[model samples]
Target: MSDEVHTEAHGQVAEPQEKLDPEVRARREAALKLVRKYGDPVLRSRALEIDRFDDALVDEVRRMGRLMHDAYGIGLAATQVGVMHRVLVYRTELEGSVAALVNPVLEWSSKDKESSEEGCLSLPGVSVEVERPVHVRVRALDERGQPILVEASGLEARVIQHEMDHLDGVLILDKTSRDQRKQAMRALREALEPRPAAA
Candidate 1:
């Protein structure tokens, strides 16, 4: 595959830094290509293994991290941007603390479950109530490719699991009850419809 980065919106890299350095600009421009949807075949397919954290891969990870932040999304997966790699970026807080996970694995989950509203960029405006573990522990590579284990409970844990599911080609719709899926789909359709021009 080509090493080119994909982007949705044109121009400027989505860097958290104030100045758009060359690297940052490149990453920002590349990320636009990643803002695709669940219907895309890539989203449904399995992700690729992350062997080593090299330059290009590192750049992509950073770009993805910044893009997720720029998009105001709490979490994002590599598949969300057309890469079939098991990588994800997320922020649990708006104050800029972030988490970048590569080849993440959910090591353990709580028996307890909770219902929460979940949505995805690929799924667009469709949001659904889904049941998920209240606590989860995951092992993943940090941005530098170092192994890191994270144990989270409550909302933070829920967000991690939700994004991790995207890595495995699982959407909330797939887990939701059929009736709920149908309702969410209807709402999505309505939201997507083009509005009539003003009279």
Candidate 2:
């Protein structure tokens, strides 16, 4: 018997995750390839906030959305794609569409916390348990450069927090206990190592 408790979202009855668009798949492949694995120097620096808000910024953000989707990631930060802008993108069909938040500010969060399993596109096959606020309020600029506030709970809140952490150069490995971190890092390191071809 499974030891873990399973819910609708976490079980076989769960809704099928949305599929990535073809153009987005091609875009992600042609450009903005996800920097999978940890320890890349670019993933260690803080991201710059979006200030100019021009057509170029819009194009970058758009690419990010396609990248995130085609990479099969529910959320992605600009830093993960080798960009230093404090931009993030995420989506769920239930939420309507892919959304980008520039220079997001975590205005507030509930004191209540929950530990959940999370995986990252950048981490590639690595997952870790993370404790996070169950609810959060974030303020950010939309793709059109319009100001907006986001109130999220449950999985949505968790996804927002995870992506936002990337702006500060944080990763899922940093969110676990020491032992778990050690184990995960070892596994990640093994995955990063090139495998020998069959004889």
Candidate 3:
């Protein structure tokens, strides 16, 4: 199963992704948010499927979107925000905005795959190569609880697969080779280290 994980993703490649909508981005900036970094116990946990689609669920999705934008991340997962629920928000390139999905299930993936660089909000600065299906079909519920089926390829395909992996406690480090994982670990360690206070 791990062998199927891909390296290339939809957005924020080796650089930070800029917010598309200024008004929306301004509102998002006003929202205080936090993203769970590497070594956080929450990031290691498998998210629970969201069964109840109520106001609380809606709030959660909105909050996730705020955090994703705040972190300049194209994609974010429930686990990344310290919520162990199978939910995620990603900025759609076509729509130029974020979309929230709950309990996403990958129904199909193409045999042809590609490899590319991916960075996670949870992992901070480390970007590793990932190989993923160029095309995929997923079934999920919108934040408002409407059923939706997404057929995506290229970047969108990569975004869905990447966020879905997080729901299962899978990180880019887990999907990479041993050497890449080592580099990721070392970077994480450095990020965790205490820095000298400025005078």
Candidate 4:
């Protein structure tokens, strides 16, 4: 759920903000403003199960969807936005419609696993290669509180697992190789470091 397209060609490097269209850049900036960054305490805190399904919940889902789209992310978790509710919004396909899942549970997962590169909006500019199940069945409630079963494979399954990790305060860094974790930590530190004032 990084703020950049998830593709082999793009890999770890994100497109320079200056290279983006003005409007698109502005939207991304605005969306990132609402997302909790790597060092944010909220990003490490596990979310609580959502108990209420009201107008406010619906509104929050809508906001998350818009933010995900604007940030060029495939998925987003409530914790990523400083919300403690166990909710997530995602769209596996770049041009697909977004779906909201509340209190999602990983009902089943295939023994087959695959390793792929993953990025996070919270840890922008950092990508980690992690292994995950190739197929999964999730039981969750829709935004409206209705029970829903999602059987997904491939990219969809990966996206669901990624978002689920966010709910538990587990990050890609935690599941990557030691060297990659060290590299990601360095990048995070540099991102948090203060820059010299313009001369």
Highest-TM-score candidate: 4
Per-residue alpha-carbon lDDT of candidate 4 for residues 48-130, written as tens digits (9 for 90 to 100): 99898999999999999999888878889999999999999998655679999999999999999988888888886687888
Report the candidate with higher TM-score, 1 versus 3: 3
Give the number of the best model, judged by lDDT: 4
What are the RMSD figures for all models against the true structure? 8.4, 5.5, 5.0, 2.0
lDDT scores in order:
0.70, 0.71, 0.73, 0.84
Q: Over all chains combined, what TM-score does candidate 2 have?
A: 0.82
* Candidate 4: clashing residue pairs, number: 0
Model 4 error, position 193 (Å): 2.2
lDDT of 4 at 195: 83
Better of 1 and 2 by lDDT: 2
What would the TM-scores of all predictions be? 0.78, 0.82, 0.83, 0.92
Which scores better on TM-score, 2 or 3?
3
Model 1 earns a TM-score of 0.78
56-146: candidate 2 lDDT, tens digit per residue: 9889888877665455456778888789989988764322378889989999999999887776666644666789999999999987789
Residues 1-199, candidate 1: write the lDDT tens digits: 0011112221112234356567755664455446876457887787887887789888988878777765546677888888888888876654457678888899999999987666666665576667888889999997678999999986678668877887888877887889989987887677656789999
lDDT of 2: 0.71
Report the poorest 10 consecutive residues by lDDT, candidate 3. 1-10
Per-residue CA lDDT of candidate 3, range 19-130, in tens?
3367655654343236777888887789998778899989988877766655456788888778888998886542258888788999999999988777776775576788
